[model samples]
Target: MYKNLTITSLLGALTIILGAFGAHALKKQLSVEAMQSFETAVRYQMYHVLVLLVINLYDGFSEKMKRTLTLLFTAGILFFSGSIYLINLFGVSAKSIWFITPLGGLLFIMGWSLLFYKFLKISLQK
Candidate 1:
């Protein structure tokens, strides 16, 4: 639990730092489209970080479920945001790694779908 918390906290800080870096430092270096993509990555990363934090605090989920959700969201952020950062910062060819971004989005969808399924089970119980 503490490990998850620590990871999530670090991710949150990293998200903020990257967002600021892109805005202030990379603004002039990157094209408008690249800058927009960078911002999208930062936003999605922060959004997932927030969800991970909440999942850590919420006690309703079994430990296994929590861990699974955390892994999914974490991987999603890394694949999605990390790829964009690589492309914008290192001039990596997006065509080479295009599949990765969609895979990340799929992870996010799976995580959310699992959560929704759990909620449905709980709702039906009452």
Candidate 2:
């Protein structure tokens, strides 16, 4: 939990820094579409960071399960947000790698499904 907390906190911080950089540094450099895509990446990364923090607060899961949840969330952010960032900032055409974004979305959906399952299982036990 502590490890996830720390990782999430760092990720949160990076989200803020990147947001600021996008607003100020990349504002004039990138096209409007690219800027929007960059913002989408930052938003999703921050959203998952919050999800990680929330998961740390839940104590119903075993350590292994918690780790799995964390890994899934982390991977989701990496694949989803990472691909968006690359495409928007690094000039990687989205058409060339359209499959990656959906894969990341699938990871995010799986993470949420696992969380829901764990919480539901706990509620039934209670």
Candidate 3:
């Protein structure tokens, strides 16, 4: 619920702010590749935020499932988007932490999988 909605709203707002900052402020400061990476992070973060909002609106899930989805999505955003932000903004080499991005991607995949399972279960029950 409301907690998820509130967090998603904040995430959405931050995504917008970060996107604008990347476009205007970091455009000149970062390399073209770094800027692109940063933009990717912002895009994924926003996408998941929207997904979280949609999940919140869907009432078919149990509280535990909702919580699990929230946690997974939140962690995915942190690890995936946060790592890219750190690399581009702080000049951390991607090679040093190549593993983190994929782990985050895995979490994102798991979150979607759980959502799909729930939807299928609900549909089959009808």
What Cα-based lDDT does every candidate model obtain?
A: 0.94, 0.89, 0.91
Q: Kindly give the stretch of ten consecutive residues in candidate 3 with the minimal lDDT sum.
A: 57-66
TM-score of each: 0.97, 0.92, 0.94
Give the alpha carbon lDDT tens digit for every residue of 51-121 in model 2: 89888877767878878999999889989998998887788989988988889999999999999998899
Whose lDDT is greatest here? 1
User: Between candidates 1 and 3, which one is better according to lDDT?
Assistant: 1
RMSD of each predicted structure: 0.7, 1.3, 1.0
TM-score for candidate 2, please give it: 0.92
Alpha carbon deviation, residue 65, candidate 2 (Å)? 1.3
Clashing pairs in 3: none
Per candidate, the number of residue pairs that clash is: 0, 0, 0
Model 1 Cα lDDT, one tens digit per residue, 81-115: 99999999899999999999999999999999998
In candidate 3 the C-alpha lDDT for residue 23 amounts to: 98
Error of 3 at 13 (Å): 1.2
